[model samples]
Target: MLLAALFLLSACKTEPANQGFCGIIPKRLEAAMSYGTSLYLGSMPDQEFLREDQGRSLRQIPPLEVREDPMAVQAVTRGRCAFSIFEESFASEQKELQGLKSAQLLYGYPDSVVFRMYVNPAALRGEEARTRTLDFLDTLWSDEFQSKLEFYGLKPVPEGLRTQVRNDLPGFLTTASESE
Candidate 1:
């Protein structure tokens, strides 16, 4: 009985879904924390005036914490994304993003940031993934999408969705410039 119990305990581990990509854990965590804290902490500090927006957003969202487990990887319902309009943008073809399992902001330099939906190697069949990525990008960058988010008394798209998966989803505001 003692040996069995010990074995069970040893079998348990703690790490995140993308443990093999440990090198990225810090940067990803930093991005989520950096963006979330600023947005969450940016709420109006007035209680009386805020009462009018009760149904809209009476409370601020809590900051997100990164979870890492080694024993098992569960399907995550959320992702993180942080972008600034001040950054430069570039287009990323599918061939350039094969290792990416999700959509995200990739900063190659101070002014060279690409908003790309990367292939997960496992997200879907190769052709299906390519099609889905293009479709997702179109929907995300649509003017209607941004307007809807702003109409909801919410910040723009990236600031509106407060989920880790938000980072994995294509962002509407990060599209490449027409001149680029």
Candidate 2:
């Protein structure tokens, strides 16, 4: 009876399959689940390092125009590229990439935020799963994705700012979560 009770308790303590950061789910996935939501809802600088780049000021630009301009599209594409590289650099340290997906929110930028959900090795099984995941990620990085980001207040991450945010994700998540 005691052994059976112990087994039940351990099973109850197991983490859910669908929890954790957008890119990687942890063993304690629930503790980190809020982090992913926070990343989507938190207020990131509209333009990172805008002031340093040729005196361009993201703050000065109207949000509507930012959403519509070709240059802005290019900038966002660059930012996404940089974000991908950054994600890869930290791949071993973080969880495996599940694929990029978006969640819709009325108040968030672009009306939706793109997320790269990570998959556990336990979850990876067949070729179909892998193919679908890759396709989703590709869509998320396409021009359509850039348009979505622009529709929200977010612009492409500047290289310098991207580095800063990558370095500071933990602290940023903490602060953002606390405020909520």
Candidate 3:
């Protein structure tokens, strides 16, 4: 009976699959699973970084808890999480707000987290709707909005990249307009 009970207890204990950050699942990180929801990284650059660069899939090593961006910074500061991904500017801002002494820079992904606006064709069923959506998209690319990006803690793509994007815009807009 004693041996059987010990075996059952050992089986219930969580174990790390491997060593280091990539191997750190909720159990390994010592984070409370009840604190937040599962990390929902749908198509984010952080997801790709874990997959390609770290050789780990979120499925195999899910975080115990995933908080909102600002809360994530606080979690790290408070030692609730082993580490969390953040935009450099946003992390700095949060660190200052939380009075953290410092935030160490982790690996930076080659691609940046981008902000994009997508309007569903189904949502634009009428001509007026289509026109309004197009105008909204155009306004997003306008110099006025571009200038305000930094104020909102966003950085605009470089001028060369912006020119390339502008060149591609006409065809994209035409396709969106033609969509039923």
Candidate number of the best lDDT: 3
The TM-score of predicted model 3 comes to 0.32
Query: Model 1 over residues 12-115: C-alpha lDDT tens digits?
Result: 12322221111112222334333323333353234453353233221222212233332112211111111111111222221322223444432333233433
Weakest 10 consecutive residues of candidate 3 by summed lDDT:
2-11
Q: How high is each candidate's TM-score?
A: 0.24, 0.26, 0.32
Top TM-score prediction, candidate number: 3
| Per-residue lDDT of 178 in model 3 | 67
Predicted candidate 2 versus true structure: per-residue lDDT over 66-116, tens digit per residue: 112122222112211111212222232333222321221112234233223
lDDT of 2 at 54: 18
Please write out the lDDT profile of model 3 over residues 97-167, one tens digit for every residue.
Answer: 34322222111233355322221222222344334333433344545445444543445556565555445
In candidate 3, stretches whose alpha carbon ends up further than 4 angstroms from where it belongs are 1-111, 164-180
lDDT ranking of the models: 3, 1, 2
Clashing pairs in 2: 22-116, 22-117, 23-118, 109-152, 110-152
**What RMSD does model 3 have?**
19.8
- By TM-score, the candidates rank as 3, 2, 1
